[model samples]
Target: MPVYKAPVEDTLFVLKDVLGIEKFNNLPGFADATGDMVDAIVGEAAKLAEEVLFPVNLSGDQEGCTRHDDGSVTTPKGFKEAYQTYREGGWIGLSVPEEFGGQGLPYVLHTAVGEYMSSANMALTMYPGLTSGAIAAILVHGSDEQKSTYLPKMVEGTWTGTMNLTEPHCGTDLGMLRTKAAPQPDGSYKISGQKIFISAGEHDMSENIIHLVLARIEGAPEGTKGISLFIVPKFILNADGTPGTRNGVSCGAIEHKMGIHGNATCVLNYDEATGYLIGAENKGLAAMFVMMNEARLGVGLQGLAISETAYQNAANYARERIQGRALTGPKAPDKKADPIIVHADIRRALLQMRAINEAGRAFSLYSALQSDIAHRSADPAERQKADDILSIMTPVLKGVMTDRGFENAVAAQQVYGGHGYIEEHGMSQYVRDARIAMIYEGANGVQAMDLVGRKLAANGGRAVMAVFKEIGDFCEENRADERLAPFTKALKKGLNDLQAATMWFMQNAMAKPDNAGAGATDYMHLFGLVIQGYMWGRTVKAVHALQDAGDSRTEFLANKLVTARFFMERLMPETALRKARIETGCDTVMALDAAAF
Candidate 1:
């Protein structure tokens, strides 16, 4: 069975040391988010995750979710109750606006909570995870009436939300989606479409399901420019803010997926459903991005969460699973064999997971901090800069963290050897569960394209240059820190490599579009690794500073330094390979004829 102990100490290090949660407490609406309150919140969330949710993780996978013929869905046993517990505990509104019955906590702290929830049970967590994204969208783009109608219910967990963008023939190509929405005399539109791969689309965990759907208005221009967003509820709300009659929405079927079985992936059919327009007509794609950006970050946290959980399980197993004698010699002569952790190779795997997980945690928190800055900054320039950096980092977090996260899961499973392959051991599930993170919420490939093709070139490359400057300043600040000297040097080298790769793409993209396409994925990973290296260095500096000040948890702070070194030595080296591939240009990728293979 899978066992999860929340890494609360490490979480605090990232929050207080790396991202400065103390400063966040001084922000508007965050006066109550003091250190003690933050700790209490995380403590409760961890307890719920480990005690309430972790126990059912394996069972959820085994039972999966069931779909009824009447178009309703049933989550695994204990999921409904677990969701209720999550709501009653105020977890659902951790970072929501205060006007909507939320605690209004900073996202930096909520990032830790998100990681814990996902680690406990990603499958069940998706139900609320997606709801959070939907609620965030309405909070940002929905009209006041729309917000009044949905945000409270969503924040209260009485009504959950789903995002419907994918169709049978369209995955990443939203421009090709065929869903249609027609304006009616009542001002509300009538929506008709079939959407696939809708997570939490028809779950029984909430009283109402609100779907933020993308469709093209009638007589609108073709392709993406004509697309519009609509709010389609499973059941319409009455005058008193309660679910009234059933809407013309039904689940046709559910997909049998590789993982996240506790959450339903439904094929939803909307037939003349009453839909309210969100934002302006012909601007649906832009509106959907509000939710997408939030979901992308959440998905990134999914990556970090799974990696942390997998590493803990693997580390615990390593210490207890005694096998061969130590390579240096028999260290446990009285026992049958020494623990696997004594082996250098086993240590390598564990250390790699540790380094990546720690760095990933810091990176996610840093990104969340940027989000808070973008949302709450008093200065327009500060907010714009934050938004630019956040936009560029979002794809990196989603793509690289998830890809590395899946790798860490595989590494953790490898530590288990034969035992990892068996389902009953619960090690294999990590790998299975981690695989979908790469595919969903925009595939890592799509994320890479967005990074290199769109974000890097946006605002005439100002965004990319701004990010480079930030990294450069960090390197300069930490160049003198003896403990972080090596980390700073490695970060500088990685940043140079990223810049070189970007220049190569910028020069060649116009001549050969395939050059960008070919180099997009690897380049994204390269950029992510470099940024993560920078984050690790920052974390090391913060932790060392705290240690110098005679703080408690010196051992934990020391571990941060060690992990920073490990990440710089092991994980950051992958950037060299990616650079070589990007510098090779599009020759190999575009060389083959259509039918050559």
Candidate 2:
């Protein structure tokens, strides 16, 4: 069976040592999240992941989801039961506020548990994953009545949620959407449209599915400017707040997808669905963007989760699969051949996977910590600062991590040779699953463009400059630390490359706009590499601190130092290539005429 175990120890170390999450206990919902309490919470989550979710991953991928004549969908055999257990355990509302039927924990804690569930089963975890983003959206922009009616049930997982933005004719261009919401006599709107790829759209796991739909109100202005958001449930609510009459929404068909089969991706038909407006009259895109942003971060987590699991399974296979004798000598004399792990080539792949994944984890956690600070900090400046950092990191985490995550999955598959290609081993599923993260939640290319176009100039470039300063500060502080000299030096070079790339874009993008578009992906990746390098530097610093304090995890810290060195010396050079690519402008890219191609 393809199995997974949460990297709990590493996670705890990052949470406590690297990020120093303890100082944030003064904030609301973090009072009880001390080191021991955090450990217990993660331990319980690990059990649920191992016992409940991990066992069904391969089966869920194989069986997929089934749609019925009545437009209801059924998940894989064990999925509904597992969801109930998740609901009962308060897992759905892990970080939600207590007033709304949640545990009232910090967002970072939720992220830790989310990573665990994601690694256990990306397909199954998505059923609840989309719901959390929906919850975030409603909490931020929903009306009082909407919150009272939706938050409690959704938080408890008795009812799930989904976002409906894409239409048959529109994908990235929401202005092209044709979905219409006509105002009703009783203050409800009648929604009519077709929405495709609506994940968890009509699942049997929940009593009702609340959809945050993007629709244009009748007679509203054209394009994205006229868009409006709505709360269109599968079943309309009764006077007592219980699910009552059936709504006009129904799934027309379930998509036959490449992966994430356990969660229903539906083609929804809304024929005059009774809907309630959210946010302003013609500003649906503004409201929906909140959920989209949250979903983007969640999608990035999918990338990290799949790569982590793929790495674990691949590492295990390498240790057990017998192959050619070691180049040096027969490491296993009794056996005809040594394990494949003894081969230097295989070791290279494994180390690359390890370095990227560990750094990805830190990148994710640090971003989540920023989110908590942004949302919960008492000081206005602190909140604004964290929010700025988060705005920049969001696309970086989504685009860069998904790209690297897909790469790692492919590399892990390569470790198994032909066996990896077969479905029985399940590596192919990871690849297919990871592929969607890059496309959805705004394609990685779009994410890159957003990073450079919108985020770079935001607040007079404060966010990007702050990140640059952070790297410079770390390098300055560690300049004389002989133990950390190599890693610091590499980080400095990566920072220089990143700054050069930024300067090139600023100077060239004005004369030729395509220069920015052509190099956006490369620039985003360059930024990702520098941020990951910073993550590793902080991780090494944390390890050294533990060692200096006479902590007993010396051997583990040594391995961590080795991985940090590998990332700095081996992987960090990619920034140079990326920067070089960025400086190449868009000559060849735009040189070809449409007819010539």
Candidate 3:
């Protein structure tokens, strides 16, 4: 069986040392997230992940989810029980507001521990993950009555939630959606439509499923402008706030997916279901995006989670699986042959995975901190800047992390050679699970287009420019420190490449839109390389600062320094290639005609 030990200490280092999360004590929840509290939370989360969730991962995947004749769904054995344990422990509402029966901790804390839970069991994690996103949308856009009716129970985890946006015909284009809502005399609406690929759509794990569905109100404008969001419950609530009448929604079928089988990806059919509108009429897309953006960030973290788990198993296998002798000599004379880890090639693969996972973790947490600041900071200027940074990081994080995440999972599998392909060893599961993150929560391609087409130019490019300045300032500030010179030097080069790519889009994409479309993916990656490099630079400074303060764990610090160096030396340079691809523009990409095939 695959084993996972959550990197609790490493997470602490990021939260406490690198990001200095305590400095934000003026923010609502930061004061409560003291060193001791943060440590205790993550440490407990590790126990739940390693001991509880991980033990059921392979079994959950193998058994999958089952749908009954009555439209009730049964998750794999132990899933319901595990979910109950998770709910009882209040894991679902770690960062939800106190008003809604949550702990009201900083969002970053929730994000930090989220990595562990996801790495342990991505499928199981989705159940609550989707709920968190729904809660966010409702919190932001729902009316007071809506919040009172839904937020508390959803936050408490008794009623899980799911986002229903994709219809049978529409995946990325909400304009093409046909789900319709008709107004009722009692201030409600009747929703009739079909939503496809709904994760956590229906299950026995929770009492009720709160689906945030996107539908067009009757007589509304056509396309996306007409779309409105609604709260379509599986079981209608009575006057006493208990589940009363059975609503007209049901799970029609379960999708036989490539991975995350434990999640009940469903075809949900709504036959004039009683619905309550969220936000204003014809503004559902804007409201649902509140959830979509949150889901996108969560999906990005899934990339890191899967990559981390895959790397752990692969590294362990490399240390034990005897294969070829090292080219240098027999490092293990007693063995039949030296372990695979003794070979430079295996070491290279392991280091790459390690470098990306660590930096990716830091990148994710840092972005989450920005979110906390954006939402909680006192000063308007500070909030705007932090929100800008968060906005800029969102697409890059989702696009680049999952893209690299899938690649790294494949790389990890390659390290295990043939054993990785077999199911028993469990590497294949990681690869399979990692695959979906790139495709869902707005496919990475769409994420890339969003970055270049919309995000880059939002508010006249304020967000992107602000990010560039932050990276540039970091590079300029640290380039002179001989100890930090290598990191800053490489990061500077990457920043330059990223800036040049942005300029390329400005100069070329406006005239020829396809130029942006052709090179958007590369530009997204270029931006990712720089941001992760910036993370490493910040990590190195923190490590050095800790060392100067007489902190122990010399070995751990040394390894971090080595990994950070590897990132700068090996991974950061990829920015140049991405920039080159972007500069090549749309000619060859768009030159092919419809008849070419």
Candidate 4:
């Protein structure tokens, strides 16, 4: 069985030292988010994940989600009670606004909590995770009345929320969606559509499910411009804020997939469902983005979470699994053989997983911090800068973190050899679960295009330059620090590669439009590796600072430095291969004609 010991100490170090959780506590509306409060919240969350959720992860995959003939979807056994515990614990709305029934924690802290939840049971966690995204959409674009009607209950976990964007015919290409919303006699509209791959679309976990759906309104233009967002509830609410009549929404069926089977993926049928319009009539796609971005980041955290979980299990296995004798001879000659961890290759695999997981954790936290800065900063310019950087980095976090996360899981599983492929081992679940994150929330390919084509070009490349400047400033400040020497060098090389890739794409995109599409994915990953290298470099510097101050966390800090070195030496060099591919141009990818193959 896969083991999961919560990395609580490392998480605390990142929150308290690296991201300044204390400083966040002083921010408006977060006065109660002290170190003690954070510790208590993280500790409780870890316990639930490790004890309750982790135990069910294997069974969840084994049993999967069940679709009944009555059209009701049933998650695996224990999911209901587990969800209730999550709700009662106030985890569902940890980062939501205080006006609602949420705890209103900062995103940075929420990111840490999310990592723990996901690490334990990513499939089960999706029920609440998707609800958080739905809540975000309603809060951002819904009318005040809508917010009053939905926010509190959703935050309280009496009800849950979901994003309904995909359809039977349309997945990523929302422009082709045929879902329609027609005006009714009352203020609400009638929605008719068939949405597929809807995560948590229908479940027994909560009393009500509020779906943020996208459909074309009557007389709207063709394509994406004509699409709008609507609020479709599974059950209509009464004047007393209780579920009244059953809405027209129903789950046609549920999908049996490769992983995340603990979370229902429903085929929803909205046959003249009672719906309320959010934002303008034809601006639904834009409104849905608010939720999509949040979901994207959450998915990225899923990637990081599963990787960390896999690493923990694999590392523990390596320490105990006795195999062949070591190259230098068996350390336990009296025993049968040496542990697998005694071998250099096994050590390398474990280190690879550790380095990526640690860096990914820090990167996800940094993105969350930027989100807080964008939302809570006092100055307009500061907020704008935060927004710019966030817009650029969001895709990177989603695309790179998830891609690397899957790789890390595979590596960790590799450490187990034949046992990794066995169902009973539970290590393969990490790989299976991590795989979807890359394809969902906009495929990694789409993310790369957005990064290189749109975000990089935003404000004439100011966003990209700002990120580069921040890294440059950090290097200048820490150049003299002996502990940061290797990290700094790796970061600088990564930056150079990022800039060169950017220039190459921009210069060739006009001449060959396909060039951007062809090279976007590889380039996005290259950029992410470089950015993560910078984050690891900064982490090493921070750890060294803590050590110099005679802090008791020297061992922890030293481990972080060593992990940073591991990342620089083993992981970051993959960018060279990616850069070479990007430089090779679109000829290799697009060389063949339509019928050539």
TM-score per candidate: 0.98, 0.99, 0.99, 0.98
lDDT value, residue 134 of candidate 1 = 92
Give the Å shift of residue 551 in candidate 2.
0.9
- The residue pairs in collision within model 4 are 229-284
Summarize candidate 4's per-residue lDDT along 355-465 as a digit string, tens digits: 888878888988888898889878789888989888999999999989989998999889999999998899878889999999999999899989877998889999998
lDDT of 1 by residue, 343-418 (tens): 9999999998888888888889889988988897787898899889999999999998899889999999999999
The lDDT per prediction is 0.89, 0.91, 0.93, 0.88
Query: Considering summed lDDT, which 10 consecutive residues are worst modelled in model 1?
Result: 21-30
lDDT of 2 at 524: 95
- C-alpha lDDT of candidate 4 relative to the true structure: 0.88
Candidate 2 lDDT over residue span 457-498, tens digit each: 888999998889888999999999998888899999999999
Model 4 Cα RMSD, Å?
1.3
Q: Which is the winner by TM-score between candidate 3 and candidate 4?
A: 3
Runs in model 1 deviating more than 4 A are: none
Residue 580, candidate 1: Cα error in Å is: 1.4
As a whole number from 0 to 100, the lDDT of residue 572 in candidate 1 is: 86
Indicate the residue-level lDDT of 503 in model 2: 92
lDDT of 3 by residue, 349-381 (tens): 999999989999999999999999999989999
Q: How much does candidate 2 score in TM-score?
A: 0.99
